[model samples]
Target: MEKTTSLISKKHYPILDGLRGVAAIMVVAFHIFEAHATSHLNQIINHGYLAVDFFFLLSGFVISYAYDDRWSKMTVTDFFKIRLIRLQPMVIMGMIIGAVCFYFQDSVLWPTIHEVPIWKMLVVMIIGFTLIPVSLSMDIRGWQEMHPLNGPGWSLFFEYIGNILYALFVRKFSNTALAILVFLSGCLLIHLAVTSPNGDVIGGWSLEPTQLHIGFSRLLFPFFGGLLLHRIVKLTTINNGFFWASLLTVIVLAMPRIGGSKHLWMNGLYDSLSIIIIFPLIVFLGASGEVTGKYSTKICKFLGDISYPIYITHYPLIYIYTGWAVGSKPSFQEALPFALLTLIGAILLAYTCLKLYDEPVRLWLKQKMLTYKPAFITVK
Candidate 1:
């Protein structure tokens, strides 16, 4: 018997990375505009919430591409450790940022924030570190968010669930079985989308039953669909894939709401079709293309690096922005400067976190946890 190591770094899809960054930036913009909108139909980036669904699809494709074949040499523990190192550091940082900014966000939007005990907020932060969602009864803020300190953590919670399902059950699924699962999940997604009262697939940050249904409905189709796609689709070369895909993504997310007050389901149908059809097409294009020049490559790299940090950490700042907007009730022109500042601030903070915290922490964790050899292993 010979000792062996199972840690091998897989090549990433750069265009996919860039697309992710594009979507993350759009989410920040969406949230910033959310402060002024009276309802979903009138929001600046009406379909920006679809970015989460796109992310789920990307995760599925990437996970399958990276790990589906590695189980032959990797233990379940190894897979989990790898995921934690990659994802958990920023999660902790996001929660901390949210906690630090919590009191500053006290306003008409979150009336109880100023009065909430510091100990209770700390408790929420600690639980947030583990990604275990708090109950509504425990909500310190008036908003019924599962992770009130950091609302984006809800998507991450579902992300963890997808990973667990993969390691424990879905990884073993044959392409046929996975296809069936994807089909069923897709149906559920479509049903939920078209029938939703708001005519969009938006509310998944809460822990209540309806939101949970929205959560799982939003999670399963795109995730497993991406997995199934990776299993089935053959690669083809596409020129300037990043530019085209990024353009298409921004267009879809920035599109105005389809239906007005009387035709809400029209918007829901649009959401379903975009998630089911358009997003995967974007992923396919992104995965197939190569970065052509030094300039484009650098742009992709920067966007990829800062995408997750911007997404996970920026919402705390949004909390402050929302507080101000609600209290002051400023016109769009009056609010423009602050909104732009918030966007710039979110990008800068995300970049700082990426350089100072996420990269170093992940590197250290990988060295400690993933770089090891088994003593009694047979080399095949």
Candidate 2:
């Protein structure tokens, strides 16, 4: 059989790599100017973190968009192998990084600034490595714990679990669309809890005080939306799927007290639906390559590329960097610059891992374990 095309190289979809750049920036901006109280940009920046939803959706869409057709031909082993290689190395590296930082400071928050206990340090490190947030605890796994570092990293647990399930049952379902929509509805339910009484979105969705552990149910849909949107776009072409729908959703978002506000329960899902629409809209436009070349170029994509590492590192660091009055926290003015500096630093570090560590380590493992069939190499 012909060697199947690999997912790694630029030839498959150049636009998405560029698009990844966009996602990274939105995340970064959320920490920097967007969420910065000094700039008073919180209206967008606070909400801008929602772009992480776009990333999740985009991941889902891209995964299914790339491989859904080949599901029957792919093996369970190959599926898992590729995912492990793609995810685990970064997770390990992030944990190591978090551990080292926690050790340096001894405490990440001011109240906790007296010092982080060795036991709390171990638990925080464990969460970072495992990617699962502490569930039943009142404080959640990564934050409010004694040592607590890297709150953003918790989402990966769900990402990994969801991918595994998709490989097993959901990926090849005849009613894939229905399944995705249903999953989306579940996320909407979680969204309802996170909704403020005033109707503004919360920093993160968790009906149960903190969504870290069990929040997986809600996060599942962003991934599903991307996957579903991918299929919808393939069926419809760029003609209508991504761009138009995304715009519509955003407009709907601006006036929260309107159409969606009434249904009100699934506000998280309602707003996230806009993300699915917006991401494709950006992709479709970027595919043209005309806009960024002329304008909208300086910040968005640059921030997007580094966004993940920034997101992973920021929250946990907040305690370390700021805090004088017991969880009063640092205002965005003081925190924003430090956040950006740290964000840029993380991107450089994560790149080194992606290039020097991740690829080499993955290649070595794949060669050692897998059958080495070219068709099985999803990320060549």
Best by lDDT: 1
> Relative to the true structure, how large is the alpha-carbon lDDT of every model?
0.90, 0.52
Q: Supply candidate 2's per-residue lDDT for 328.
A: 39
Q: Write the per-residue lDDT of candidate 2 for residues 20-43, one digit (tens) a residue.
A: 554454555444443324332224
Q: Let me know the TM-score candidate 2 reaches against the reference structure.
A: 0.70
Q: Estimated TM-score per prediction?
A: 0.95, 0.70
Off by over 4 Å in 1: 1-9, 112-114, 371-380
**Candidate no. 1 TM-score:** 0.95
Candidate 1 residue 95 Cα shift, in angstroms, is: 0.5
Ten contiguous residues minimizing lDDT sum, candidate 2:
34-43
Task: Itemize residue pairs with steric clashes in candidate 1.
Answer: none
lDDT of 1 by residue, 1-380 (tens): 34457555566688898899999999999999998999887999888999999999999998888778878788899878878887899999999999989866667777465589888999999999999999987798768999999999999999999999999999999999999999999999999988998888998899899999999999999999989999999989999999999999999999999979899889999999999999999999998999989999999988888999999999999999998998999998899999999999999999999999998997788767874432221110
Global CA lDDT computed for model 2: 0.52
lDDT of 1: 0.90
Off by over 4 Å in 2: 1-11, 33-44, 106-115, 135-147, 175-214, 235-270, 283-319, 322-340, 372-380
